[model samples]
Target: MADRDWSIETLHDDYRQALRIDAVHYDSNTDLQRIRVLENARFGRFMTLDGVVQTTEGDEFIYHEMMTHVPLLAHGHATRVLIIGGGDGGIAREVLRHPSVTHVTMVEIDAGVVEFCKEHLPSLSAGAFDDPRLNLVIADGAAFMRESDAEFDVIIVDSTDPIGPGEVLFTDTFYGHAQRRLRPGGILVTQNGVPFMQGDELTNTMRAFKALFGDATCYLSTIPTYAGGPMAMGWGTDGDARHVSLETLQTRYAASGLACRYYTPEVHKAAFALPGYVARLMP
Candidate 1:
């Protein structure tokens, strides 16, 4: 089995463990359009059924921030937000950072993941686990999108890799459905995943998004957990806002007093800078 194949080969890296504690994924498969959860421990390593450690130190935020913030900032007037997956609650936590945002509806298929996050990883989720502004609905995001008439200002697809619960969210039909769920001038952002394992996956996703939305872009952010490499994202909307200048954003996005290790408007602008392989696929 591929899980055993991966198990035998996956080397231990400091990236997946903490404090003599480690996690491992014993087995994983999607059924009924949901990623099944399983947990395992090996040689002091703790792993999830998804074959990755469930840890507070995980770099899920770096990708979630870049995926959600860049587009929300670009719009500069987003109020209502929708996040698919992210039952871990990081995206919902970040979405509230924008003063412009009034509410966020997070639709995730796995109630177990949501429960675990609230119980165990409050620090990583930053107490937004039970924020009044957040509505955490445990349901399939695609079905919710189909029945959803309430349009959002921005929608962030914060799913796992395509193989598991998120396969539908990656398809052209889902993109089409997302476009329909958005307001006339709404933006969509997605965690398109590691650019290394699947060459040109970013570009291909961008191509599909472009066909659905007039404006589309792919961006990169360094995430330490995913395959020991950087992660990529896809963004699309009808119109582009004049970018918020770095100097202006410093004061605008809460306390110019604090600093972010990875996100700067300058970084946000540069994130769109793709390598030769990804850039060539753009129309």
Candidate 2:
């Protein structure tokens, strides 16, 4: 009998993780990047873009919930939200959970990522695509931020690592444009990769954020599929949302009626407390 195929992710030069493939659900090259959907016993179904593990069914809730809920709940009232590069729809699914969010503009550079994920990884999105509040726009996220005069109370950057198509999203120019698109007191959260393995990524983004916003720091969440150590979610805003008291967060969490597996008021507060290594990386 032949050995099962393996999907190896080489995000780091010194380390790599391989998933023994139970099945090959989808594998093809989209115009923007190569997309692969593989099934594994441990992770269920996971999707990768350009050979990088984007999200997995086993622990996606951790990333999505933290990325979406922290900023929205901190802001206290975020009706209009913008999501840049979350084609897999995990972020959108989490964002729509907030009843106060009436509008969500999700811009993806690759339409193929959305279409394939809808077809292959339905569980990740649930029914976010059908949600009327979502305004799906197929365009470059950086360009959209620059061109659109529309303002958002919260903006979530659910991008892949700063490579290939996702590189531009981490630039200072893009961050500046996103800051301009934000309403006063609005929050911008970003996926800043795992700090232990990608220290430069965190440092570069924090430097850009520090220049762009009054409050610029990062929060941590551990996702197994992402490899390395704890991943950092970049937080930036002129508002005092990051300093929202624990009592306020608890009140908001209870009022939200959100049953989350990983994200709790306590976890939200603790996530922002950076370790010395991570703190040193911050500008």
Candidate 3:
């Protein structure tokens, strides 16, 4: 196999992680960002946006399953869901697994990423886009939530790191808007970066979450493609969601009958048990 290297510009440091690719299937400058799809022997087919690996066929289940299941299972009866910035459709695929989810409104800022992923990264989405319950909205996510009168049972911010187009989603004002758009007992989850390298990202999001929801916490998940220690995910809600019992989680897990590769009921309960270094990042 020939050597085709790809470099990722992570958020915290100047150094970039290089990936060895076997070949490039698609590489284009979209309206919003530069997107690339490559086949690798180790990682399989992977997609990157602006030099950041968004998802790979090999380990995508870890991030997608944990990010979607932890909050949904905790909420117990989330019938409606809102996803912001998951243009790759990995989050939507997981969210649709729950039979209780009747409607999913996905707000993505760029249509290019979605189209590209649908064409080149088909396994990542797994036909989730064609689901009848999905409502695809091509617009700015922050602005879309601010203008909409609808409320969701769960709101998930599956955003990129706090930079470029994804920077505004991490703002306090955007959090407030999301809070207002949620039902009284609704849960809100966000993708905070790796705490070891992006401590400020977790802390800053915790500050915003604290201001809006009294019960705000974070959970951890290990993803090999992320290239750091365990990744942190933001969890916030007004009710007793973060304190859900293991029995309740197990009950919900059994009721859903969703077989996941990375997210087990026990793992959902334990992901909240953060390490000392990561716990210190919590506000």
* Top candidate (lDDT): 2
Q: Write the per-residue lDDT of candidate 3 for residues 201-229, one digit (tens) a residue.
A: 99999999999997998999999888779
Candidate 2 residue 206 C-alpha distance from true site, Å: 0.8
- In candidate 1 the C-alpha lDDT for residue 275 amounts to 83
For each predicted model, how many residue pairs clash, with residues at least 3 apart or on different chains? Answer: 8, 0, 0
Whichever of 1 and 2 has more lDDT, that candidate is 2
Highest TM-score against the true fold, candidate: 2
* Superposed model 2: Cα runs more than 4 Å off: 1-4
Poorest 10 consecutive residues by lDDT, candidate 2? 1-10
In model 2, which residue pairs have backbone atoms overlapping below 3 Å? Answer: none
Candidates' lDDT values, in order? 0.68, 0.93, 0.89
lDDT of candidate 2?
A: 0.93
lDDT tens digits, residues 88-175, model 2? 9999999999998999999999999999999999988999999999999999999999999999999999998888889999999999
